[model samples]
Target: MKKLNYLLIAIFTLGLATSCDSSDPAIIDEDDNQSGTTITKAGLITANETWTADNIYVLSGKVVVNEGVTLTIEPGTIIKGAEGQGSLASALVIDQGGKIMAEGTADKPIIFTSVLDNITVGQKKGSNLTIANVGLWGGVIVLGKAPISVSGDLETKQIEGIPATDSFGQYGGSIANDNSGVLKYISIRHGGITIGSDNEINGLTLGGVGSGTTIDHIEVVANQDDAIEWFGGTVNVTNVVTYAQGDDAIDADEAWSGTLDNALVIMGADSDSALELDGPAGSAATEAGYTIKNVTLKGAGASSVSKYADLRDGLIANLQNILAYDFGPTSVVKVNGADSATELAAGRITFLKWEIVLPAGVTSVSSLITGANAGDDTKFTNNATAITAASAATVGANTAVFSWTYAKSVSAF
Candidate 1:
């Protein structure tokens, strides 16, 4: 873990170097206008640590829970991430074999946001930031020793957001049922800190997570990148809401074979695709198909971008029971020409019961299908049926579970 510690040490040093900045990056025991103690966390946590609701936690730098360590956060606890970029970004990383017992209930959910946020103790959200504000800090990255379909037949690969020099950033193994622990009813906001060009930390990045881990009732608001990106994980998620994302709302890559059930996506300004689905990179988990169901996508953003699924890499997927509406005129459910067409013919890809309220001047669902290859679009678009907005509301995500989210408070639902 020497190399891993060095990775965090670099971030710690960077935080100290930026303490004189105008934002006045938070330090330990600083009066952040919050109640109780402000526990500043940085670098490696080698032993078990429990964060109670009585105090607030601040991630001053890249705080990593080392292998065999357990970092538990009590419900109603508020944790903030310090502002930084690249190697200096502040984030909470659960390395392979580390466990995070951060289980928050519907009534008292855990909150993860930027240190610049004015929200303090016992508050769900702050007035200083809105859904439009983003990239204030880094987000959560959880890695595990599970199977991933990388280019080589490798046992592990470094997660993308972390620099390659850090060996602790590596994730993946033969542990199909690896236990990383539980994350429920948590809201990650104003994250997706920039790492490099076109590379930013996702709101919640699950790299090679396994089925033994539990992630449910999660809400990501104002994430600068993908709200939740699964890089080759078999862990199923439930009841998620992602709103005001600057990039793709949901993304899955490297043969993530799991189900994302009951999800709600509300795209904001500068957002792109509602779904960016990528297939396996290599031979591993090729037969395992991705399953996503029960989604409500509202493409209400001003920006005319990739408004639908951008399927690529010869994915074998199943998307069902979706209700999408209010998209721009240019958006389409894109498929990569012949590869997706071939997959559809081979029964590797399927779509079921998609209901969309077509934008004005579009009278049919067939107009929504587009791809570099002409033949595939027709077949893929056949699953979609046009419906009225009134009937469209009856389908997709159970908004009741997202009552604790900041999105709900702002009526983003």
Candidate 2:
């Protein structure tokens, strides 16, 4: 009886010790869950909040920053969007009066990827995803109250790739200096989810973003749609890089009067044009156009079908210091529509110092742009005013600025 009582007492003492110890295995397991909080963010962010780098955020659905709210994100933060399709797609949207200050450095760039990616906290790359993985989730969309062209001269217009029922999708106003926010050293990858037929999200959709917004050192990879698109705004971008996109690398439409400086586009397997320039639609065609300089477009060279650039929809652009190389033999810079040709004749749509290295069997620039269709063809070669046979671009995207990018890791440059 004494031995039995001793054994029962020992058991009670051990249980008491285990319960009193704060660092017990069970307690530690419980503390692990509470140590670093994983925030699941969805719906509208009406209050101001700062997302830190230590915490992981999962965007389950459409996450919108409501008006007057500011969402600040720390550098090296990884934001992952859940795998969704149709109306259930996930995206991060900044409403008209909302702001997002996501400022990152070359050493620590902010990454936006998909939840399907196996990247954890503090990791730059994922094991499950690569540059070939496209359309994994939706992309970033920023709407602002800036000038945009509309057929009916409406003060505001609904942005495409979104349902019209979502009133927050509408952008554009008279404020040319409307401020959205800042985005620097940000890399968006594996995005551009398709919502409907011929409607898909872009890597970075700037809808009526104004000059007050600061966007620089941006990189987008493996997007299913255009890497970056500006729908009528004065927001200028610098040091932009796009790789392995499924559509146009850079698409400017709705009379985007912005300037894009120092851009590099490396074509993907299913890519279309390196640059697709479309002016204002219908009666709003008289608005200011866009200007692009110091661009290097590397094509797929006989293995892929993609255009160097396509200028149409009455676009008025001034393209200078462009270097296009390794494109398919038939790929050419074609100008469609009579309005675009008229702009070319008027010197409004002009190309200066454009050096193109065509593929085999494609000789002269004239052979590419035959001008066999309607409208004036001589405007492309008037005294070598436009489409001048010049040397390669002396200045393109500074490769050093993209050292921290995924493209650099894969030697895309």
Candidate 3:
């Protein structure tokens, strides 16, 4: 393992020196050239390693941190993913028992962008890729030995965007507080490659990640699929922002028993729902609902015709202090299916202190859910106790934290 690490470092240093000598005339001295390592990486990380900010790491294909290995990335580090589709898609996968201590400060956030981006090692923004460039590559996938619920009540299941034959793609276990690692102040952009029909990678995929993992200040922009999706995990998140995603911004499925605090979702013109929540496929004791608070969801316009949220699949949710606005003429909140409506009626799923701004001609929240043409609002009668209307918008994620993100630079905030 030690030899492998040395070899990797040597290779990285050699690549950096070569690139700097050939491409960058500004780097004239050997001292500046020795400051960082550059690696075009793929395959498995068998041992613990730390990636410094001075270095640039590029992912050419699917890279996995095997079980019992640790991958630590310093603040301001820029990782790039190559472009591909189907079997050739690229990503960084932290397998079960693997740990990634990627904690960056607000001033120096870590970045994971596409290889097509012209970002340098020390700079935050690239000259090439913008928020409009979407689905350029794959994204991050973290798996842990946490509890999940599958159709057959299986303890584990394979995640999407990866081949089923790869057993390392599987996640789930009995431990609710199982620790994966820490992720803070990270930005992922221009990702979400389609591996198959209706099977595309999310900007950030948390599959059975446990509560012990610390995740905060995450931003995903212009992803082809969901910005972030939790697949039956107890991992809580805070200060998250998703912008211009093609699919749902924040999607919680498989009965993710987590908490989302201070999240902002901004839909693009081609985006779908701002939020998509679903429950477990089968009955499992560990599979529980989620709590989301202080969220601001905004769609493109009436031309987009997307919903603020679709709560379905018999999932229990506690939504509080949410401000939903700028959506099209679609339903603001749809209690999907009969089972979900029953859950909403029983107070298992609740929404409190929501400030909504519907499109033109939409009179009431009742009309939005039941369709303006529908005669009655009886379907949402169960949610009457907890769901209420507010005139002024008061709930949303803090815009201050997004100052370092591209969303802020482009004034999307």
Candidate 4:
């Protein structure tokens, strides 16, 4: 896991190298047959057709994806959202059974950022990384039929906050063999609105996605909510990063059965927990079981509370080979319920032999493990033994470190 500074510097250097060959030979070849009219609003993008962000496609409403269609975005293309356009001005949305083959190379990754780009020498304003600055103004939403348990009835329900419910919104489908598309080497910056208390669209929302969907090398920066929200699916993700999110870094609920490996999260001073696993407590059977490995979480201040908070029923979270540092007064690991504590201690919620470098004045793992019925020690030791066995050979390897400037950067809103 490379540090944040190293990653940014590497990207910046790569940007300079590729800034010269910004030509699209394919554009000229394809435009010869198609009309020269520019697309400025939402519309169905056909398969085998190459789409470019001419004047920043403002999605005033839902963008539908017809079956057997594929939407391909060119590399180095910038998609900007409208500030006043509410939540529809954002970039592309992949409807159920539709595919988005946004294959951006390391040298030419597609960037979805805020429209505001004016900046002074040392000032940071109107940048795409602000939580409230909803430029191009909405995030990305992918709806599929991949085995998901919704909070409400599985009848015809609207995705809250997104208008035009009848047009592009889905009405539920079979979870078998549901395929969205492949998303790799893409960056979603400056998204997530303050929709209301504890409810805002994230940088990327995978709703009812299935195992057939492909996800890799994704990054979310400065989102108002969790960088990535998994609603119910068997999606497997690798090499993911989240930076400066206002809420949790990664949130999973509604019976989300997924595998997350090699995740790096660097939190700001005001950000919330690193991982939050909660099923609507009122509906426990709907919660999902998650398996996670090789996670590195680093927070800035005491404001950086718990790394893992479990509030779900039948939440079987197996965390192994983790390294957490710079925590506040709270525990590095906390199970919100007494029963959860028991399960966690009894090696059920296994926390493999790990290391935590606490802040200068704090040294206690007791607060992290509260509630008991007398068999607490056996559970704790069991968890420790499991951790030891799993993490004997590889521990504290490649911890991610981040160094960012606090200077206020601005983007058009």
Best by the TM-score measure: 1
Better of 1 and 3 by TM-score: 1
| Candidate 1 residue-wise lDDT, 128-160, digit = tens | 998778988989999998888999877788887
Candidate 4 per-residue C-alpha lDDT over 1-413 given as tens digits, one digit per residue, 9 for 90 to 100: 33455456545645543453321111111111122222333445445465563323334344555556787776544554446444444545676767777775555555665546332212222343354443235577777776555555462234433554345545234573567888776667777765555545678887767777788767777776677887766677776777677778888765666778877666756567787765432243333367777776666656656454434443566677666665666644545666566555555565675555555455444445444445564343344321222133344323231112121122110
lDDT of 2: 0.79
> Candidate 2, which segments miss by more than 4 Å at Cα?
1-36, 286-288, 370-393
RMSD of each: 6.3, 9.4, 6.3, 11.1
Ranking by TM-score: 1, 3, 2, 4
Tally clashing residue pairs in candidate 3: 0
**TM-scores for candidates 1 onward, in order:** 0.90, 0.87, 0.87, 0.73
After the best TM-score superposition of candidate 1, give how far the Cα of residue 406 lies from its true spot, in angstroms. 0.6
- Across residues 236-295, which tens digit of lDDT does each residue of candidate 3 receive? 999999999988999988878989999888889888788888877778733236999989
Better of 1 and 2 by lDDT: 1
lDDT of each: 0.83, 0.79, 0.80, 0.56
Candidate 2 lDDT score at position 158: 77
Which candidate leads in lDDT? 1
RMSD of 1: 6.3
User: 144-231 in candidate 2: lDDT tens per residue?
Assistant: 9888887887878877677887756888988889899999989999999877775778999999898999999999999999999998
List the candidate 4 regions with Cα displacement exceeding 4 Å: 1-39, 43-48, 52-61, 85-91, 118-136, 152-160, 171-173, 280-288, 338-348, 370-413
